[model samples]
Target: MKAAAFDYAVPKSIAEATALLGSNGAATAAIAGGQSLLPMLNLRVALPDLVVDLGRLEELKEIAATRTNIRVGALTTHAAIEDGKLPEAFGGLMQKVASKISYRAVRNHGTIGGSVALADPAADWPGCLLALGAQ
Candidate 1:
């Protein structure tokens, strides 16, 4: 399983990364930690012509608490949340889910957005997110 040839670039912001993706068309992909994307690429499940790294996007890495609800950034790592670094409302829940994630290594690399995007029914957070109305 070999991945297709592709161009790689780390964008400083989401706007720049989105621009790269738009320019690269449907074959483009945004890679965060790459722990998941690399395996998909190797298995030939994905063959992007452009890989826009979102790891450097500070805005997407933030986890903040607002009046409406707690905000888990798209690129926020499971480990970060698991380490009790998130808001008080989500702190215990994050730890519970983080402990049961695929694995500690994968959890460290996985993200809230990645899990949500995959929409895997068996994923732990889906049920909780749904029950708690975590939009």
Candidate 2:
């Protein structure tokens, strides 16, 4: 089944996005990669009246590596991690885990944050991230 009709918003900043979400509350859904959310939407498991897309939020798509930490933004795709675009501080573990996420097609569209948020029992990222002591 296809998703029901819904309003959409592309917030330019995290503050705007959060405000939108806060106002919409139960009626809204935040869409980053949409890999996990879209399927649920299609199956009617999620029937949000509004979808707040974070696609235009460039800051959320970033992967910043510091001397002591690697900051992965909420919208960073698994494919980026698999492609070695993230900080080398992660060593090879992130790529190894990313390569094992379902398939290349899914990895290309799925965000690490989205994967963790879903908290699928069988998901690889969550376990790997946990083992790596990620916050």
Candidate 3:
């Protein structure tokens, strides 16, 4: 099934993205890598009036790590982790989990934030993050 008609926006910055998301009231959906969302949209499972694409938000793609903590941006893809793009301090747990999420095409487009935010019990990222006590 095709998605219901919806408007789409690509904001230049995080603030702009938030503003666009707020403009559509409760009918707004934020799309990053679109791995999970695209399927839902195509299946009409998510009928948002507007889709605010977060792909251009570079801040959401950052990764920073310190002695005490690691901050992974929401837009970080599974493929990145699988390819050892993240800090080595993580001990390869993330890489192992990322490599096991579906296939390479999905991993290339599926994001950690999308997986965790979707809150699917069977999703790997959320369980792994939870086990690691991620904030």
Candidate 4:
């Protein structure tokens, strides 16, 4: 199915993105990775007047490691987690969970943020995130 016509924007920063979303309000949808949102858009389940693409925000793709915590960016893909890119503090729990999410295609492009945001009952990340006490 063809997706509904919509305006698209790639915001360079979180502030700009938030401003765009706020301006569009109910008519805008933020897109990152597009693994989940693409399917929904194609299925006509999500019809937004404006689709804000956050994929270009490099800051959001960063996975910073700290002494006490590992801060994962919104665009951190399942493949990155599975490849052991995150810190060892988690004891490989996220890697194990990431490896188990759907298939390789999904793993390569699907992100932790998207999975958690979608919160599908069958999605694995939500359970893992909750178990890990992630916010």
Give me the candidate number with maximum TM-score.
3
lDDT per model, in order? 0.81, 0.88, 0.90, 0.88
Question: Which residues of candidate 4, in runs, are more than 4 Å off?
Answer: none
Task: State every prediction's TM-score relative to the real structure.
Answer: 0.88, 0.92, 0.95, 0.94
Stretches off by above 4 angstroms in model 3 are none
lDDT of 2 by residue, 1-135 (tens): 999999999987899999998987788998888998999999999999999998779888888887888999878898999999887666698988888888889988899888887888988888998888999
Off by over 4 Å in 1: none
Model 1 scores a TM of: 0.88
Model 3, span 43-118: residue lDDT tens: 9989999999998788999999999998999999999989988796767899999999999999999899899888
Ranking of predictions according to lDDT: 3, 4, 2, 1
The whole-model C-alpha lDDT of candidate 2 against the native structure comes to 0.88
Backbone-clash count (model 1) = 0
**Candidate 1, poorest ten consecutive residues by summed lDDT:** 85-94
Order by TM-score, highest first: 3, 4, 2, 1
Evaluate model 3: give its TM-score: 0.95
Candidate 4 — what's its lDDT?
0.88
In candidate 1 the C-alpha lDDT for residue 103 amounts to 78
